[model samples]
Structures are given as structure tokens and as C-alpha cells.
Target: MVRRRFPVLLLHIFSMFAGTAGNTQEILYPFGPEHRDLETPKMDDGSSAEITLSISFVYFNIPYRTVYVNNNGVISFNVQVSQFTPEAFPLSDSRSFIAPLWADVHNGIRGDVYYRESTEPELLEKATQDVRKYFKNMPAFTATWVFITTWHQVTFYGGSQTTPVRFKCILLLNLA
Candidate 1:
């Protein structure tokens, strides 16, 4: 018997991101050559090693200085997320999971996943502006730390390698 694969529809990936203890807003940050500083190794349902952030960020009153980004589109704090499918919100577990678009991503077959933490003045300034625009109530908001991850031209677990999706997730911290 011949097999046919159907496209898996996912929630608007860009609108999904995890943040510190507060209201989370969607910010469109540039994911260009300047931001692609590091890359996740090629693998199926794999994740980057626990990456330490430049600044400590708190979630649920807990501060985490380290995090990891998985090929399946999960930026986790406190632990590595091996789960490929996205679980319903208000997760059953206590681990901080940021599901950008958790999928059975097989990057080993095709594509590149990049992540980096930034404190560069220029980048920070841009992030600050973006946040301020969204949080008009906090007109003086300035983003001092940011974690950016992008799945550039990444293919699905069994989809055609030629067709891919490009998306990014950005987490910002403004302790001031």
C-alpha cells in the first residue's frame, strides 16, 4: 500500500512564547545574520544543551539562569524537554516550557535551528522599542536581556525537505 502524508496544522507559532512573571506580548524581533550566533546540532527530536542566559530570569517566582532550545520548538527553563508534541497549556508538570511550535522536527534530515542570548546595545535598543510599543502603559520599558531562537527553513518529521517553515521566538527581560 502507498502512503500519503497530510500536513499538520499548528497554532500560529509566532504568537506563542514564554516570558517572565508578567503579561506576555508578541514582539517581532529581527532574526538575521547578526542574531544567528549559535546553532542547535542536527538531530531528530533533539535539543540544545542547557544554555546559560546572560541575565537571570524569573518564572513562577523562580529564577533561572540556564535554558535550552529544542529542535521541536521548545525553549525550556530548568530542564530539557524531550517531548515532541505540544501539550495543552497550563502544563501538568512544573518545568517551564515555552512551546513555540513543538513538533516531531527532524532537523537532522534538513534545516538549521539557531539560538543566542543578546545584550548588545543595538539589539537591546530595538527590543526595548518593540516592548514599549506593545506595553504602552510602560512607556519607559527597556529590554536589557533577550533570548532569541529561530527555526530557519526547518522541515517536519516526514514532510518534504524542500518545503519548510521559518519562525522565531524571543524572550525579553526588563529588570529596570
Candidate 2:
């Protein structure tokens, strides 16, 4: 298959390719006290202290047990990324990250970032249902690990007041 931008966002359960199945909107997962919150201003160009994953998450078939959740909507496996602007795909650099919506963002002035790793029964069930609904071939998939990073009500960095953005990346690792 062609190398495409990561597909299948859990938001409203839609693939990156819209119009293929009339997927136009993104419906994010509901956040509550369950997720760990990231501090602001401090997290403007910063990232969360490294988190040891409850279970290793394999990306590109490489197993990783640690990660840094950056304020700019990315879950990084290498060093935390503070670059506001996003590089094109097939990058020349070696930064490893899963960007749900990487951009010049700052939670310092306004907004919040939250993250968590869970295997909660309810969450797992929801994740499994979502994956099956979007990726039809994975009808029997059941998530054993779930990682979520959310940037909510965040403003732009080095700019005047801008529209607040709310987005999230939910990674479901089916270790079954």
C-alpha cells in the first residue's frame, strides 16, 4: 500500500480519506478526570516528563516502552518536539512522533493538554468498537492497550489571539 498520512482517527471514527465513505467530521473521545493533565505555559514549548508505557507499544514494528507527550499535539517516542511548524512526511530527520495535529501551539497562555495510558474495560470496549467500525477488516480486533493525548482550548504561539483548537490522538494497541 502507498505510504499515506496516518489514517483512522477515533474521532467520530473516520478515516483520513473523506468522500470515500462520506467521512467529513471528527468526533473526539470524551475526556474526564481519568486523564492526567499537563501543566500550561510551562508546557507551551515543553513536553510531559517521560512516561513508561504500561505495555510496550510497537511503532513501525519497533517496541517502545517510553514516550513523551508534547504540548503541540504529538506523542513522541524520541526526544520531545518543540518545533511549532510541521515538517512534510517522509521526513529527512529522525524525530519519531505520532502527531494528531502538530502545529505552532501554546498552552502557556491558554488551553490544556491531557494524556493517559489505560486498559479500562469501558475504554477498551469503545476502542475496539471504533476500530472495527472504521477498519472493517479488523472486525475481531480487541484493544489491550490505549494511550490518549489531548490538546484542548489551545491557542497559537507567537501570534495574536487565535481560534482555540481541541484535538486528540488515541492509540489502540491490540496485543491479542
User: Where is the poorest 10-residue window by lDDT in model 1?
Assistant: 3-12
lDDT of 2 by residue, 61-84 (tens): 677789898887677896888887
Top candidate by TM-score: 2
Show pairs that collide, candidate 1: none
Give the TM-score (vs. native) of candidate 1: 0.78
The TM-score, computed over Cα atoms with residue i paired to residue i, of candidate 2 is 0.79
lDDT string, candidate 1, 72-129, tens digits: 8888988888788777888887878678777887788777888887788987787777
168, model 1: CA deviation in Å? 0.8
